[model samples]
Target: MISGVTLLDYRERYSTKVYFQKRFFTVYIPFLFWSIFILFYSLILGRISISDLSFASIIDGIINSKFLSFYWFFMPLFAIYLSIPIISLIPKNKRKTIFEYIIGVFFVFNSFLPLVFNLLKIPYNSSLYIPVLGGYIIWIFIGYYLDRFDLNNKSRKIIYILGILGLLLQIVGTWFFSYQNGYVDQMFKGYNNLPSWLYSSAFFLFIKENYHKLNFKGILSKLISLCEKETFGVYLIQYYLMEFFILVLHFDPYSISYRLGASVLIFFLSVFIVKILHKIPIIQKLC
Candidate 1:
């Protein structure tokens, strides 16, 4: 949804060159800086040995985002940013049809087909390949589509119902499979799955539709604005804060209260740290 807003903003206001430059400075540079910082932190914590630190290894880490596992999201996000020039070329008149077709193709091959194959115990041989329509890219198109078009009351109602069903399927199916298998199962929890897509889309639509109704004032508004501004930095540094909580503070992972408390504490701490970092001229841009 954020990416969709970005794409919309870019297409409506900025040139491709300008967008690319802004993305480079704001996103790419910060990603690079944070990846390296994580790498150094890992080394200090003995998660990685000094002997493993070489120029080639560092380059590999940056490219693969090995410093933090979830940081792999950056590669796809970067690719999406790079493809913006081509994606933005879709003429306004045909965008609705084209985007719908693209999203449909993606849903079938990437989500539905895989689920079908897995259920039927059929090995996928890659017989029919639709390379252009798959993965996180689908979300970008979905985001753009949702942003560009408005759904009627009937359509919104149907989508909301399906989304609720999707959410139930995700939660119940995972629990059932896990219980049967005597282990945790993540089969239904992937973002690329049908359930995830439906749930996410519905949630995005709900927020978009109702955003104006939510009016915050005074300290609450200021705090929300501050957190929003520092979100990127918080995301970048959150892993370390989590590690600090778990390893240093010895927070009980199994305790629900501890988990909830830790989450709130980590978020505020990360925001505070990022806010402080922003005050330093040299470090501000990197974050």
Candidate 2:
């Protein structure tokens, strides 16, 4: 939704070059800085040694760090920002065709192609040029297309019903996959899975349709303002915060009580950490 709004503004008010350039500086530059921070944090903890710290190692950390696993999202985000201009070029009339094409490509590359390759014992890179062609591409396109119009009452009702049904399917599908595998299976947890894709689309549509009805005042409004501004930073760092809670404090992995307590602690800690980071003049950009 945010991307769609930004893209619409770019199309109406800014030159393509300016839009792309701003994204590179605003998005990629911060990502690069935080990625470096993650790498150095790993090194400080002896996750890697001086012998492992070659120029290639640094490049690899920037490209592929095992310790900072959440950084994996950055590659796709960078790719998406770069591709936005081209994606936005499709004529309004042709959007439906483009949306359908993207959905078809997702199924072909993410679902069907993988099955074919595995059965044939073929090897391939699964990242698919990072975010540009990954499973989340469908959601990106769907959000963009949905942002172009206001859904009617009937359409909203349909989407809401589908959303609930999809959520149920997602839960059941995850359990089924886990049972079949005799372990926890993440096939349904990802954005690319059919159940997740459907659920996410419907949920977003429901939100977009009803967003106007939500009213926040006083403390709620203030909290929302802070979250809207700082959620991206929170996202970038929350994984590490949770890890810290688990590793340092020894939060019980199996106890629901411990998990709930740790989650709340992690969230508030993350908010405080980001707030402090944002106060630093130089680090503010990265935050």
Candidate 3:
């Protein structure tokens, strides 16, 4: 929603090409620089030798390897940004209909296509397509639509009810699916799931409704403002920060308390690191 608001305002103030170009630079340049840093850092740390640093290997690390597991987020986000110009050219009245159809198709693909492939014994690779067609794209359109149109009170209440139900569905479905799959991981609760779609819609609506009620002032407000500013940096660096606690400090991954504490520690550490990084001119753009 925030991105939607900002992009819409930019569209009003600037040419479409200029806005698209600026948005591309702000995100992609940072991503490319970060990926390059990862490659060099791996070389320096002896994780990869000159022979292993082939063009294909470097590209795979940036695009698919577990060394940069979190970078998958950047790929779909970039795809969404790339689609903005095309979506903008779409007629306003037709956008919701088109988005609904696309999301519905992809949602089914994410949730059921794998099962169908398994049943048919077809060798299908989800990784090849899920990032581009997954349900996260639905939320991007939702954000844009919500920014463009307000929900009526009745609609909000209905969404709130559905959200609660969705949360329940997610919790129950996780347990059920885990048992059926003979694994403990809640893989069914992926970002592309129906439960996530419902829950996220509800959660966002709840926040939107309640946001103005809370008096955000003094230290609390300032802290929130800082977090908002540092969020992209936190996202960029958080995987490594969290991993340090697990790898170096040897925090037990199975312990909820340890994981929670590590998260809190990483959050503050990431914020501080981002603050310092922000002071530098070129690096500032990435953070």
Q: Which candidate achieves the best lDDT against the true structure?
A: 1
lDDT of each: 0.82, 0.71, 0.71
**Model 1, residue 120: C-alpha shift (Å):** 2.3
Which is superior by lDDT, 1 or 2? Answer: 1
The per-residue C-alpha lDDT of model 2 at residue 197 equals 63
- Ten contiguous residues with the weakest lDDT in model 2: 128-137
Tens-digit lDDT string for candidate 1 (1-287)? 57866774476787878888999999999998888888888888799998978999999999997778868888988887777678778788898899889888877877878777876879765655368854477788888777779989998998899889989988998899899999888778788888898899889888778765654445556768879989888888888888777789888777886677888888999999999999999999877
Q: List residue ranges in candidate 1 displaced over 4 A.
A: 8-11, 125-129, 216-223
- Which residue pairs in candidate 1 collide? none
What tens digits encode model 2's per-residue C-alpha lDDT throughout 224-279?
Answer: 77676677788788988777767887877678966778777777778888889889
Give the clashing pairs for model 2: 76-131
lDDT of 3 at 231: 84
lDDT of 1 at 144: 75
State TM-scores per candidate.
0.92, 0.81, 0.81
Show the colliding residue pairs in model 3: none
